[model samples]
Target: MRILAVDDDLHMLQFVAGELRQHGYEVISAENGEQALARLEQQTVDLAIVDVMMPGIDGFELTERIHTDYDIPVILLTARHHIEDKERGFLAGSDDYLVKPFESKELLFRVKAILRRYDHPANNTLTAGSLTIDLKSYELRSPNGLSFIPLKEFELLALLASKPRHVFTRDAIIESVWGLDFQGDEQTINVHIKRLRTRLEQFAPDVKIVTVRGVGYKLEADS
Candidate 1:
């Protein structure tokens, strides 16, 4: 699964990301909540591991935002281990809570359990207005015509189309489309998005890939 690991401390962030990666997870790290939110913009993630004691947006607020805006699970990581803190985490919409300096195995186990519990069928398709995304056939139907897209571009379209107006950050897009293990940079995502846009223009006159300057892209249906 793809996991977004957020922490202000560089060492802690690397440690957590490294540990998660070792267990075969695609791990993406952000320095703070702001960066984390930016990451969420460009990509679709399965789960998020957030640090509670960040400078700008704390873990609780971040968790709330994630739950409110995105369809992803969140796990709060904090140094504070009080009952009240745990309550706040849950109240903020965290699916799980992990105290800092935790064992790697425990984190792995929790991630596994949560994923299994929340897992849904991968064969499902999503539709937005006249734009039909066929997951099974890897085809996208639009007003202009039907376009049989490649697997990666199809995922890119699906992510953007899932929330048409939502701005996906380049980091977020790469994580969802390319996997967190992707060693490439943002240019790779840009390239894929450009090609996806070309395909849309050719076969989807009513649907367009709208670019949000200094952010990412989204799918906008012509009004």
Candidate 2:
């Protein structure tokens, strides 16, 4: 999963980013709320951690904008621990609040909890039509039977399946699945698509990952 860590304190931002990365999450860092907004426009992350005390576009305002514009979950990482401050954080649409001097493990747990709740995988499986992708069980099921889904393939397919029939451009796919800093080209996407097709052919024939000619790709059911 990808997380955006926004704070004006460079040291704090770096610490959060490094900590999240150590936990196997892809972390994006922004020095302030303005930078965070710009990063959001260019990258897609599962969650955001914002510090409340910022020079401008304080964490509360940033949280409101994030929830409103991106519909992404946010956790307020502020020093303020007062009851009213937390109320404002929630009212601003923060899914959770963590005061400074927090344990990294606790932050990781909260992030996972929110993502698990929001993404709401089908008991760790995602299904469309007769096809199912079981993340926990590491099995893909269809009318034909079951097959294995590799990590990148699963991430890519799941992303596309998250919004069936909605075309995803290569750039968007790269940013979403691979991180904005991934040093790969369109061939990377093509290779993953090819492999995904090979795996899908083992099970789901009616369900197709269609490339829109010059555009990108989408998942569709032959109806």
Model 1: worst 10 consecutive residues (lDDT sum): 120-129
How much is 173 displaced in model 2, in angstroms? 1.7
What are the runs in model 2 whose C-alpha is more than 4 Å off?
A: 121-169, 174-223
TM-score of each: 0.64, 0.61
Model 2, total clashes: 0
User: lDDT per model, in order?
Assistant: 0.84, 0.85
Question: Over the stretch 1-223, how does candidate 2's per-residue lDDT look in tens digits?
Answer: 8899999989889888998898899998998889998887666567899999999889999999988766679999888779999999999999999998898889889988999898774477777667887767767788887777668888898887766666677888998889879997899999999988877766787778999887688887666
Per-candidate clash tally: 8, 0
Model 1 CA lDDT for position 7: 95
Highest-TM-score candidate = 1
State the lDDT at 68 in candidate 1: 86
Q: After superposition, how far is residue 176 of candidate 1 from its true place, in Å?
A: 6.9
